[model samples]
Target: MDYSKDKLSSFLEVNYSALPMCCIQKAEVYMLDEPSSYLDVKQRLRAASLIRDMISSTTYVIVVEHDLAVLDYSSDFICCLYGVPGVYGVVTLPSGVREGFNMFLDGFIRTENMRFREDKLSFKVSEQIDEVVKRTGNFKYPSMTKTLYHSNSTMLAGFLKPDEEVEMPATTVSYKPQKISPKYESIVRHMLHEKIPNMYTYPHFKSDVMNPLMIDQLMDRKVQTLSGGELQRVALVLCLGKTASVYLVDEPSTYLVSEQRLHAAKVIKRFIMHAKKTAFVVEHDFIMATYLADRVIVFDGEPSVEATARRLL
Candidate 1:
């Protein structure tokens, strides 16, 4: 195989790079930093298995991950890192996976008896979840079966509850896939101009979403030069700028920090409400998911193997 001639996809690039470390030239201790960054749900599951397989009596693996789902699946013992950014930092003693996550979310460390922040972050429950549900239309639903036939395989997705349907009808969609062109080189200002509803077009969105995302600050910079987080913000604005009946946004929280995630969620929610548009988002961040989802469609079963989608109310 000519490595130089063949252009590998992002998934292949990630797996191929890690293959050398785990398969060919083995190292005593393997370190993976955010291996799930650009991967989809199925890919993250496969990666978790791959990372787990690298562990043995003689070999050790250490991973730094932000996606709680991937972190939970990939880790045995969990360590929490806390501190002011770009300053002194502290690492907590390894704890059980659940405990570590709780500590992080609660902003309180039980073992250390430390409180990092005054407030606790948690998923929205009964009342809070209800407030986010918007009524876009009144539609009828009945138990119906539709099969899409292909030569190789069949796929199914349950979009509504068994008793209900037509809540969200099929329509024209604006989809933002997980993979983006990392090599696209153009000034941010020029790049954004190429998208629909340029910066000059929507003054309100400029203040509401773009400003919070720091897009104004990045206007002079080049797309290829922007950091991952910056690029994500840019991509989001571009996706939202387009007019569509249904917006399919994949992994909007990728490369964003906690604050950025929340901000992005707000932007999406506000856009949906103001434009009277529907958005179907694929996200691993529970906070973002809780904030954006009115109803959930869960994909169950094995990743990259077989799965079933069931509607969760």
Candidate 2:
């Protein structure tokens, strides 16, 4: 629960004394500096840190944001609150947690009345457990209920409730854009000095700006301005420019628009196919997967690897 600066202040004014002081340690309560504007990237980074803290700490942390009502009780269920696009549900899992915990997620898909059979170590739903098993493929370990919700009723039913649609405020600003520093410039210059001619130098070369050439120039000009896509592009350049034997990219196309995403795919394909380097990319884009990969590993029901040459024909 990462609260914006304004929301935190208001919350403190209203419930500072009322809040359980015994629970929250003085060192744990961090009030970040107010961002310059909503577009500040540092704010997201700061919020990420706070989120990490909350997840790691034993204390129950509550984050208050503008446009959100302060609940009386702490919620066990995590709600996204913000209606970020392409998300299936509000309380799926936090990013950091997902990255760490996804490996342990054997039977944790969305479901209700699910039971774990330790003898066979399989997941079983009351009604359609068998069907789900067929669809997901048989599991080696017992399937545990993905969602753990409590009901006051006598029957303890484990069901996944539809997430409430939360309308985020029009201007619940999260980040403020940062100014490029000398360190950013030096990084870009070092990249340009790599002697890659096709790598077009941009204006603001810093990872923050949208335009590629401008981003490079900005890196030189000490002006850091960029969107998410631009930052990914800059990162891609830096990664490819290096002389690594094995390159691994994990979902590089996240938070990108259609055209830019396609362009990024093309760039990645070009790099992997033509460049004298070995690269492994984990991407959801089917087209890019088919085009770029010599041997495609499809993890649908079971992980299957096939040669692209055989599959195409």
Candidate 3:
């Protein structure tokens, strides 16, 4: 138990001290149901590690975890289960780790020729994760004397780019707009050198943000002369270029076409997870928000007025 706790500490994002309490006897077979439940991405990995630590050739450890990343990292073999809840369940014979994960995601049993789901689900995590662990994290919010309006407003996120003019939402005005560039690459270069000097290299940024948002095709276009959709894409590229603990974005889908709106949601979701950062967004697009958010805070009162913040978990 002591070894388990110590080995898990490196991957644990949250403090967990219940390892000893959860187990009283040493058994040949141990089972845990959704141990990754209630844990963030980092903690989930640690939980997976702890479960793996419980295994010996003589002992079999089974973890019923829903998180694909945790499951993939934790198990050497898997039993994919398909069934109607509380009625009947079909569990396949154990398969090698990668093969089991591929089958689970594909939602098919090749041996039985069974298709549990009509649609296949696919997703990827990229290289943006390297920087998340390097930073210290704890949100420090402001304390103010006067009441502040909730409707779209601007704030100097005191930590990012020193005094860089951030044109917030709900405002028709622009502050400190930089020189228009005929080539989009110039704008990115200027922003990189002037603002986040140590930002990930251009190639890395392109892999994490540009390719998904399709910013590369606009590389030669002038910033001021770009169309609404193109400009939105540029803005997204710039916003996601820098690294931070908390990202505040307002109405990201503005001026974007239908397809671009969906792509923007994907960009936000991928960046948040890969970077392991928190994001607060002010968006009127309900569909986009629901698709991107894991937990959403609902305004339980009048719009642009008094409202209680309720979380839909």
Candidate 4:
């Protein structure tokens, strides 16, 4: 840890500087927002451990995070915030971590008798018996368990389960990066019909992507007035509308509700398959990725510094 190292990204530098303050300063309360944003899986676990170790009997920590595993590891109690984005939000009373997560996933709070979402999200279980046997032919067992602990406290253990861009080549390529800051003042219809590149020539884009993602409903709304989820859907249509041999979709699940995400995944998957075109999707959602991808590539190391990707076989 050389804090002055030029190779460190802004995210890493911020973590290095801010985490020490949270640990050392005598503050009555500490707050962290998405501290695990750019960190890889291994680094996230280490950061969670550090946060857990820094807690004391006198201090209060309120963390705004989306990663369930990290939140589970780092929190004693969990408070779920639910509501329409850019609209009113309600926070539930603090409950045990497991219970809070269950309530969040189930889309209903039992004690308060409230339902935020229309559908519950459930994981699809898949077993690879041949792959499992092939990987574990020998008598030796692999590390299949995870342990969470504090420096001076008893350990808790559990058994668990489990973006990009660029150009080039013979055929043209189009990219939709993970984030889009809505700076436009034009309406969605204008943006769709004339604003985006090749919008006029994009055949059946509205039928293929827009209507499915429900972008037609927002056609009259200004781009700047659209919510995050609405903007994301518009972006997807823009990306898919372009005439190119290959399409790069980064984090298509961002800011989208569960139902919208599933629909987006379906639209993208169908478009690619039907058109017989090539698409590289960078997604964080398990169900979204599995549904859309034929083969998966795993990335390792730092995000922007010295990253590497290997395709799963």
Q: Give a tens-digit lDDT track for model 1, residues 212-286.
A: 687877889888987777888888988788777877787888777665677788788888878888777877676
lDDT of 1 at 236: 90
lDDT of all predictions:
0.68, 0.35, 0.56, 0.66
Q: Per-residue lDDT of 82-102 in model 2, one digit per residue for the tens?
A: 222333323434333343122
- Give the range where candidate 2 is weakest over 10 consecutive residues by summed lDDT: 148-157
Best by TM-score: 4
Model 1 clashing residue pairs (backbone) = 141-165
lDDT of 3 by residue, 193-271 (tens): 5654554356666687778777656655446567655666666666676655556675675555434566688888888
**Better model by lDDT, 2 or 3?**
3
Give the higher-lDDT candidate: 1 or 3. 1
Regions of candidate 3 where Cα sits further than 4 Å from its true position = 1-193, 196-200, 300-307
Question: How many collisions between residues are there in candidate 3?
Answer: 0
Error of 4 at 54 (Å): 2.9
Candidate 2 regions off by >4 Å? Answer: 1-224, 300-313
* Ranking of candidates on lDDT, top first: 1, 4, 3, 2
TM-score for predicted model 1 compared with the true structure: 0.63
lDDT of 4 by residue, 1-313 (tens): 5656565544445554566666677787888876655444566687789888878898788887665667889999998887755558788999998998899889899998888878886644334534222233223111212211110011101112211222113456666765578877888888777746565345576577767787757888999988767888888888888877878776776667555777798889878877778787766555566666665556654433344444343
